[model samples]
Target: MDPLAALRRPDDPACDVYLTGTVFLDIIFTGLDAAPVRGTESWARGMGSSPGGVANMAAALARLGLRTSLAAAFGDDMYGDYCRDSLERGEGIDLSMSHTVPGWHSPVTVSMAYEGERTMVSHGHVAPPRDPALEGDRECPPRARACVASLVPGEPQEWVATAAGRGSLVFAGVGWDDSGRWDLAALPELGHCEAFLPNAAEAMRYTRTECPLRAARALAERVPLAVVTLGADGAYVADGRTGETARVPAIAVEALDTTGAGDVFTAGFLTGTLAGWPLEDRLAFAGLTAALSVQEFGGSLSAPGWPEVGAWYEGVRQYTLSPEAAAAAGQDPEALRRYAFLDALLPRCGRPGPLRRAVPTIGFRRA
Candidate 1:
């Protein structure tokens, strides 16, 4: 069956996992300093916008070959309308049960800060139900296989859950992207899902533990699996099954924009897992998707499709190794260096290098 056809099927093999999350219109500016332009230096580049947040994640998941759907809320503004149109017409993402509010502008994101390390300033779009923020009418799907519970600063996560209940696998992001503020109420409940994806810092914030290991452990106590993205350190995977822990290295790449890399990682990881790909391949797929995400601007305007991600991984010789594999292959020069580690491990640099390895459970610590 066409993966997306699942959107029409509410029963078994529901179209590529259903993603119910937030959808926002994103505005990105380039060549501008995050710092204020004080005196004579007027500016560098202007501004451009794209659909982001849960919208970006949904789009990323769609690129990875999922028959995707978004249950989100958007303002009834022109930009919100454009955002919904793109989700349906341009990307073919399903958008049923989305709410739309009038008067307020759809959510917008401004990408500021420096290269590698950047930040965004955003305004909320979650108004009362009166605002028309969703892709109305025929966009709603009968069901979805998975959902993305994204808690924007003021947005409530309860509403982001897939209406499919136990049938829908839930994935959530614990962050605000800009100020790092978020909803703690969703964390404990988030533990009930099949998996959880939160960046390293967000993980730290979630569990109130600066140590990623402790954070993962604390989170796992509530859920079965938690994928903690450690920026440059790679990612730590804590599995409730088999009681194993593993660290997967990031693909090496020179990154221009770090925007949307984590969301890209989650997209690839979920796509792979739903396809029944194993943990090892899933991690590599996550990294590969992130590498492709940075190559473009507007968050994910130029994300790589599934085949492209896999090809890129093999081209870079990006493959996970057993502890024995690492021991037998010896080492390369770049693998030994500190700054080189940053390229693969640092959030600023994009891809992460190998920090450690394991047999089955790749505990998401360090990386």
Candidate 2:
């Protein structure tokens, strides 16, 4: 069920969100008791492979019922073929704006997850330059209600500005600055964005503030909305336009792998924002989706769809009804109340069975 179905109009953009970035074939190893020791062979209890990187964000958005359009470069290799098929055919993401470069091979990442943390080793060559004429798309970006931009410090993406100019609400996220200079001024593209989401560390470094909330406030001055994600503590949000601020606690869950959790959080927030949900509700929803993502293996595959969201809502409600159940699970009744907004939203999400997700191997034939 499309969350925006009721809000859709005849003249609205066909795509709900536009994303562009590099996609990597992520091979994840899970259930490891410890990191690998020097010159030792380690056996993992579980493993899975899927499209990662920007594909994580794309899958999250699509699973949440958003009409996601991706503009990316794919290789002609088997790994590339699997990734392209997984996203377009399996996940229902639109790849019309994407292209495959001949002879170029897919980027690959092997991730090891242990103790709620992951270490990744990646290898890939830079993709060839995009030729819009050959790809059969306009030089300008396609119209969409929103777009997610991965902000690289000192390197402004021109497409962000172009999409924003064409009425796309731009939401930006940044990577860690390996240069040791966390200068906010280095990101010129922030001027074109409606919101900026950075993890607590990134936010603190960029604003030179000790507190994440303070950093969010400073960032709000630059963009209309600023969100600082505090991994365990939850998220802090500041709305520059309304002079509003919100802090939502993280949902407690036994995490199996933390990969792609941030992307899932962004997807949930984007959904709530587009639906005109209240500030606190948006934060709570984002935190919940992120919590769910970490419980499963792999990055893009772990993203939950509407069925998962609905099931979680029902489980929480049922558990909270019994004091014994809540106590047994260490569930805080107060934290459960934060997601009460789901009561109104879940009924609207018609019964969709379990969503198909990425598996440990991609060799099995699709039925």
Candidate 3:
């Protein structure tokens, strides 16, 4: 069932979220004990491939039951075909605004996961420019309730402002500034954004604040909402409009791979915001989704759906109900209460069956 079904309107935007960016074919290797030596060949215990980059967030949103539309460039190669099929057929993402270029190879990233951390090596060529005519009758993006923008340090995308002007709430996140110029002024698009989500390191560097919470406060001055993700500690959010602030601790889980966890966090936050969840609930939900993502391998495929969320909620509820189980796990019962809001949100029929997951390889024939 669609989580936002109650919020649906006859005149609502065509999609719940719209995203545009490069989609990379991610080949991931897991279960490594250590980094490979320069001259040594290390065999990984597990491997998987899936669409990554912006596809990570798109997949996450779709899995969370959001109607997602993606605008991206794909190559004519097999990697591109697999990615297109996975997103469109498997994940149910709208790709009408996407395009394929002749002879343009798809971007590829090789990720090695070990000890909850990952090392990535990438190769790709610049994608072809998007054709405005392909978007629709206008030279604008498809109307959406919200859009996620990847803010590059020096380059500001005009579509962000256009989307906002067209009644779409723009949520922006930034990549690392390799130029060493952590000037916030470089991200002019923040003026047109409803929210800005950055990791702790990026937030501190951009705001020149020593603390992530202080950095989020400083950023709230520029954007309506500022969110700073503190990897292990959790996430902090400040609302400039209401001066409401909240911080949620991260869920403790055995992390298999941390790839695309930040993107998953952003998607989770977007879901809660669109659903009109409370501040603390939103942070907790986002943190929970991110926590679930890290327990699996790969990026796009690792994102959790409603069933996974439901399962986790049930497990936690059961744990809290049994004093023995609580003590055995060494988990605080009070910490589990933070997610009691899920009781009202989850389907009463019970958890759904397992959904499709990321596989070790692409291009396998389905029987």
CA lDDT of each candidate? 0.61, 0.90, 0.90
Query: What TM-score fits each model?
Result: 0.72, 0.97, 0.96
lDDT of 3 by residue, 99-126 (tens): 9999999999999998777899999989
Order of the predicted models by lDDT, top scorer first: 2, 3, 1
The candidate with the higher lDDT, 1 or 3, is 3
At residue 208, what lDDT does model 1 achieve? Answer: 82
Residues 1-367, candidate 2: write the lDDT tens digits.
6888889999999899999999999999999999999999999998888899999999999999999999889999999999999899888999988999999999999999998789999999999887746755454478999999999999979989999999999999999999989998899999999889999999999999999999999999999999999999999999999999999988889998888999999999999998889998999999999999998887898999877888898888866688788889888877797888887777777534566565788668769
Give the range where candidate 3 is weakest over 10 consecutive residues by summed lDDT.
347-356
Name the runs in model 3 displaced over 4 angstroms: 133-139, 348-353
lDDT of 1 by residue, 75-124 (tens): 77777777886677667676755666657677777665355676778877
Q: For residue 363, what is the lDDT in candidate 1?
A: 21
Sequence-dependent TM-score of model 2: 0.97
